[model samples]
Target: MNDMEEDGRRTTMTTTKTRGIRLAKEENEKTDVRKYIPPLDGQYVEKWLNDSQNPGQVGEELVKQQFLLDLLHSKISARYERGLETAEIDEHAWQVQNSITAIKRRLKQLVDTVPPVVSLETTDSRCIEMYEEKQLMATQGMLRADILEERQRVARLCWQLHNTGEDTKEMVNEDPKNDEQEWVERCKLEEAARSALLEEINRLRSTCADLRARLEMEALSNEVPKYDSL
Candidate 1:
């Protein structure tokens, strides 16, 4: 009985070893099918799918690979399109930034070359003084013109008075009843009026000359550079 029991135990061990070997061989075959089948050939999916009833793990792998390919074709393609759009936006932004830089440079050049126009809002007291001086000069010019016109009228009146005096003298010589003293008084008054007109004309001429000189000086000063050049 001891020998029979020992033989039985040996038989069970042999069967267990045989079963384990068979399972290990089957596992190695499945691993070889997954690893050695060239995925790059693009035919593994077709072969695995041809035998659907017995496809096993390889079939499930083909299904998962097909799903991944579809996802890449749909989602990744959309991602590529979005990347292209993003690149275009970045390029446009770069161009806009360059344009803005160019505009700023052009504005700086303009500012350097041209002076700003002065207005009533200018803070410079010189500008105010120059404006007031110009107004004064205009007024002086008008006054000078009026004075010249008046001088011309006065000279014409003086000539007429001299001619009338000569005519009255001839009439007085022809008529002895004419008052000689009254004629002399009228002649004296005419001379005084002529003298006054001559003095006024001379005074106006002096004032005009002075005003013209002052105007010239003011214009020269105005044309002078206000600030030092860089």
Candidate 2:
């Protein structure tokens, strides 16, 4: 009974080993079939077709060559069709890409050419204010000149009156105190007007300086680089 059991176990092990060896051999044979088959080539086909040494096998050779030629022609035709389709798809994709690029370029150009709406509005308003300030300054200058001319004229008139004949000098001396008081008051008023004008001019100069600083800041902000797309 012990010998029978050992023989049975040996038989089972041998059968499994043999089955595995058989399967491995079959797999190797399949691999060799794929590895040994020559790749199709037009030169090889032509050479085979041109051989005429075997007269008895001419008909079989001709049939085999014709089948190979048909298969090669079909493959070439299929490849050519696929190439044409791929080229068309590539061309369409290229055109789409170009259009997108052109659109982005145009948008960038517009962004560069067209100033910001808020900036434009602000610039126009500031320009108008500057013009008004210039006009005011001009008016102030004219008024200052006029006041100086009037003061000079009054001084000339006073000098001429003081240098008049004896009868005119005596008449002027009759109310000299009142005339002196009035002249002092007139000079004070003229000085006050000139001071006020100077103060206004200084204020306007400060305002212009502030405006210039703001404009420079805005220009610097605008100079920053902009992206073509997000």
Q: Give the TM-score of each candidate.
A: 0.26, 0.24
Q: Which ranges in model 1 have alpha carbons more than 4 Å from their true place?
A: 1-124, 173-230
| TM-score for candidate 1 | 0.26
lDDT of 2 at 222: 78
In candidate 1, what are the lDDT values of residues 136-180, reduced to their tens digit?
545545554665576567679889979987887666365454566
Model 2 TM-score relative to the real fold: 0.24
lDDT of 2 by residue, 1-230 (tens): 99999999999999999999999999998874533333223334334434434433434433443454345434544554453333443344344334333433444454556654445556556556645644554554455455456556667867865675455655746777887898789779978987886788667656665565566555745754433322
Candidate 1: worst-modelled 10 consecutive residues by lDDT: 37-46
